[model samples]
Target: MQDKKLSELAATIADPARHDPGDAPISISAGLADWMLAQKLSLAFTSYQTGQLIVAGVGPDLRLSFNQQQYARATGLCYDRGRLIVASMFQIWRLENMLRPGHYANNAFDMALVPRTAHTVGYLDTHELSVDTAGQIIFVNSRYSCLATIDDVHSFRPVWQPKFISALAPEDRCHLNGLAMDGGRPRFVTLAGISDEKDGWRAIRQRGGAVIDVASDEVVVSGLTMPHSPRVHDGALWLLDSGRGQIVRVDPANGKQDDVAFCPGFLRGLAFHGNWAIVTVSLAREDKFRELAIQEGLEERGLAAKCGVLIIDTRTGNVDHSILLGGKFTEMFDVALLPGVRNPMTIGPATVDMIGAVTIGNPAP
Candidate 1:
């Protein structure tokens, strides 16, 4: 059923005629592959069932390594002050370069800032993390209304919080999905599936989803379907509008959007290596990844989807290389170039983290 339909889509979608630019032997030549492997880091999980993050080198062999301890479904990761910050709804874990195998420190910080008085000012569905030159982390969410921040990862200090619209009495469900830093300043942010500012629900009256510059608390693009995962690449604000199944770029000046690439199904997780974008796609059609298993002829063989990492050429809208993943895995929230690894790293299964409203150093009134 669902799986069969997915396969049909894949059959039509996959263009085998598309080949890698340089078929350099997987193990041969010193180029991007060599650099990726030479500096590869293994952010893998100890237990496959509950692995936190896995690090691997390039080459089909995919050699793996780990730092022990499950960070509980790490959704987004960012390199800050020479450390890898892992984002999760339940907790924000920082893997310092000096972290040992079993070292653990609780209460990174606590504060009286979170309004609920019920839960930590953490994310309900944290998706992305961005750090400013000042070392502050800006995080986003899937359902929570406010974009939150931790001035110090070790302390619970709320620098910026989403201003709730009291008139609307919103449900706190409008999700903030991705974050992109504008001009090295934390104030500008791009959003996906923006909920209604009033009710924290999708305001059908407003444009679907959009790119927002939190500094001004203004929507950058209106009428988007379900855009997700954004980053600044090659001097432009590149974004993924998952709803229209297109990769788009927005003009920082006017917020006009133009399609750069289009893929079927839902696409999430985007990172860049030079000019190539490493992306993760979830083959499932209807929210749950399991639905992909029932798509049609897919039920029997099950799909080891070609939906892993896609190395995309932004200028030409061409996919350079694709790292496929096993279908047994559901969805990948975010993917990044392994700090030290050559291939790339993807944190799988949907996950979340605490976010701070974009910090506009000096926003126009």
Candidate 2:
């Protein structure tokens, strides 16, 4: 079937109107398509602002091929093996790549993700999810200020939480928001503050963030400015100091932080590809950080916040490339790299026809 016909069929089976692409204007940096081709990777990101999941890759003609699908309050994204996991408003979705190695769709497309499963976990305010060493899904449960996983019997299973939080409640006491994994286990996390009271993190949003060692239950790094997205890479602990719009590398042993890169906007999602670090930035929400340190940082640097992705060279702490978004989308939550995939597309649950169009099974020898 033709692509247009397939899309129309899918829409007919599902909610056709919900899948309409909005009028947002997206601009890719010069040579970004070529860069993606040379790097052998595609990009996936979530925009909670617009409730969308977006993928960008290089096509066979060396041009950018971008796709967007609607998912309610899409936030955290994870790409493991051939599966893509995404956290939305009240559910977790698992999407599997259906294309076999070296296979193509219509002799042109290379990656096709099909939504296969969804687990309703209520509204836990999920963020920064990853599959652990034991192949379990773990995510930052922001609503309850803890790290949690899907539970068959309950809404969620708490794996870990900040020591300062006395109990698990939907109050968002300290705004615990980032999780870092090591050896397939939750190791570190970032929070907006140390308060144990409801919405207390707001009082210290300017300079009270901290990175805590989960196992030791100790604050490894403190006095940060609304830190988020703690990640372990290249033998160092990296985090985004969102209130300062800077990427910081921390010495795990000594608790020292080195400025890796200063980006424009409020940084959130973080990932590493080879020598490059990928970080997502959003136009700072005035109500959220208007009077916070992030606003001051922007003024000091004579820069305005942006909504997009920055590809920074880790070694030199410089932004090598960027993809900028304008129009309807403003805030982004997470980003994941799709290695070795090109011209990627997804068949969402909203597209019933596309959902039944592909399948996989083992063949008899």
Candidate 3:
């Protein structure tokens, strides 16, 4: 059986010895290792529930290599060139891959991401992030309902906000969460509501979700179900309707949306790797939340909500691989795919190795 094969592979490929005893048990698809190897891809994800940033990749023996570092309320993650940027509780960390090509650490890891600098962005509840052509970091400031950039003296510099928002405040009116970049500039954003009042998005959390065009300040798409992670991929717009547990593509012209693939769990993070769309799936929160349509879909399908990574082929809507997480880890916020990076590791601030290793300039290129 397919399920049996996946579990068997997880028994061998998960490398339980490397994981902490208190950490969650991970189950990965049997073909995921081979598939990632073929594509030369690795995965980086954040678990807000567990406060950790994890990197998953393949090694020379073609086995899965999992490394993790603790970051308070780790959420949004991005990998640009040789730099890995991640959003945490009160700081945005810019990590650089320390190894050059043909270099390995301990004759194993090909890439070593070390924290080089951090931007104190306050408790703004930052979400998705992207680097523009000008090499500037643009992040979703959810609490302020705007896209913001890091500031030297201020908490964050507001770059853009929805037209409906009258002013920037910490009221979390629209709950702006996703940022879509096009031509190296932020082009679209996904929000839970178009409300301008304090916590107004909670009144219409189910069907009030919408997508706004950054340049034109127009609501290009509306009537979505808790939409998250708006993405520009292959000349098309893709996003997750989290309440419905489905990935939808928007036409942008008439606000028409077509279903692509429906995966278990409430979808959040999305990253494109060649023709494959890597997504983060999470179990819906029980407290301070209403029952969503995703629960009904899962019930009808006799499937439980999953917390892990999913790979969907954009062209045919086929779910190629899935990694499920259980135990202490039950939710994930975002994922970043490291292209051509194998057996990657991240150095946390508490680690002695980070204190010992010193490097100037860029780390990985």
The lDDT leader among the candidates is: 3
- For every candidate in turn, the CA RMSD to the true structure comes to 13.6, 6.5, 8.2
**Candidate 3: deviation at residue 70, Å?**
0.5
Candidate that would win on TM-score: 2
Instruction: Go through the candidates in order and give each one's C-alpha lDDT.
Output: 0.50, 0.85, 0.86
Relative to the true structure, candidate 3 reaches a TM of 0.91
Candidate 2 or 1, higher lDDT: 2
For residues 1-365, what per-residue lDDT tens digits would candidate 2 score against the true structure? 24674454445336634533377777778988888888889999988867789898887788888788878778899899888999987789999878878888767779888888898897777888999988899999998999999988788999998878899998888988888888988989999999999899989877899999999999999999889999999899999999888899998878888988888888899999988999999986657667767777777889888898899998998888898888877888899999878778887677675647666678878
Q: What stretches of model 3 exceed 4 Å from their correct place?
A: 1-21, 287-290, 360-365
CA displacement after TM-score superposition, residue 86 of candidate 3 (Å): 0.4
- TM-score, candidate 1, is 0.63
The RMSD (Cα, Å) of candidate 3 is: 8.2
lDDT of 1 at 141: 45
lDDT tens readout by residue for model 1, 1-365:
14574454344325322221122211222243544555443222111112235444443454321122234445776654445666653556655432223332221211111111112334345567777776666666444445556633442343343443322222444556777776666554445445445334445312456666667777667666566777777767777766555688878777777888755445677777666666766565445434221233233445333344566777798766554444244355666554543332332222231233112334678
Look at candidate 3 and give me any clashing residue pairs. Answer: none
- For candidate 3, write residues 1-365 as lDDT tens digits: 14574454344324433333275689989889999888887899998777789999887788888988877678899899988999987789999988877989878899999998999887787899999999899999998999999989999989998888999988889889999999999999999988999989989987999989999998888888789999988778999999899899887656678998888888999999888889988877773223688877887889877899999997898889988888877789999999888689999866788788786665677
